[model samples]
Target: MTTILVTGGTGTLGRLVTERLRADGHEVRVLSRRAQPYAVDLREGGAGLDAALEGVETVVHCASTQRGGDEQAAQNLIAAARRTGVAHLVYISIVGVDRVPLPYYRSKFAVERLIEESGLGWTVLRATQFHDLLVTLFQGLGKAPVMPLPAGVSDQPVEVAEVADRLNELALAAPAGRVTDMAGPEVRSLDSLARAYLRTTGRRRPVLNVPLFGKTYGAFRAGGHLAPDQAVGKVTFEEHLAHRFGR
Candidate 1:
């Protein structure tokens, strides 16, 4: 079995991908800030990353920072991969990174470009926002009596496990650049999702529709982040909520 390196393997998607691959008897190295032997901050490329990428056939890059440093991390990873002759580099990105003008999206798009031109075998999968992320968002907003959500914005959220499964498949198979997008079966509005969250947690919070400004908000409102044609994800947001809340 080829040794695979999974960056951010301690996180939700990485953990799932690592579990699946390891269960199949593959030698999987988890690379994170605290992962032993492979422990190295990807933002700063160094001997640690080179050591981790040594003899690694494939690298499933799942590490990303919302605050900053994602571009630097990918550059570091790519440099290390090139140095160690990594054959395949699997990346997971958002559906609308190229279309949306948000800071995070811009960084993600830049990373994608870097991989595409990295002169290595690469497969990039752009997936819709995760259900877990939506839960986190609603949770943070739910603390207030009235949750202020972006107006006219809808989300087609795929399950994290599904995305992980897809990544696992991509990690094993030959590099296929820019595969089909994976999205939730249903495209539900923010208000509807918030209401479902309220029902699930038995919490009442009036959702306020705040019309956000700028191109980012406009793109989201225009459904730039949606993959209506590729609504291939089976799990619904309601199902995820039920399972999470033990309903």
Candidate 2:
């Protein structure tokens, strides 16, 4: 059995990926700074990482910091993988990171470059924003009487479980550089999504479509984050909401 080490294994997507790999009968070890069984800090390069990657054939890198420092973490993972002679390093990245001007998106793009140049066999899968992320955003915004949404911004929110399944498949296959982008089945405006959330969760809030200015909004307005041509995920945001709320 191929021994695989999954970083951020306790996270949203990481947890699903770990479960999928284990269900497939692969020897899986989860890496987390706080969790047990495999406690290794990606930020601190030392014996912990070395021990984690000792017999690991593949490393599914799902760990990321939206607050920054993701590039450094990726570098640390790459160096450790090289030292351990890991056969494959699978990385999960956000869609349109190259085009999105947000700092978090830029950090993800930088990690993509690092993985590409790391010389280690690697496969990078860029997926659209997850449904859970959108729901959380709307839930936070829905607290107010009026929810503000960026105008002309559309999202193709894919399911995290689907992305996790794809990551599992990629981990088993030979490294293929960057695979096709993954997106949700349908694309909807941000305002519409927010309104849907409000209706589903019984929150009565007026969604205000505010015109957003800046490169980040420009990229989103231009549909840079969308992969209509590569809409491989079958789950729609509405279906996800329905399942979540039991509607």
- How does residue 15 of candidate 1 score in lDDT? 94
Residue 102, candidate 2: alpha-carbon lDDT: 90
Q: Each candidate's lDDT (Cα)?
A: 0.94, 0.91
Q: Write the per-residue lDDT of candidate 2 for residues 1-247, one digit (tens) a residue.
A: 8999999999999999999999999999999998886787788768888888998999999998877778878888899899999999999998999988999988899999999999999999999999999999998888888998888899999999999999999999999999999999988899888888888888889889999799898999999899999888999888899999999
Error of 1 at 175 (Å): 0.8
TM values, all candidates: 0.99, 0.98
* lDDT by residue (tens digit), candidate 1, 106-176: 99999999999999999999999999999999999999889999999999999999999899999999999
Model 2 residue runs over 4 Å out of place are none
Leading candidate by lDDT: 1
The superposed Cα distance between candidate 1 and the true structure at residue 46, in angstroms, equals: 0.6
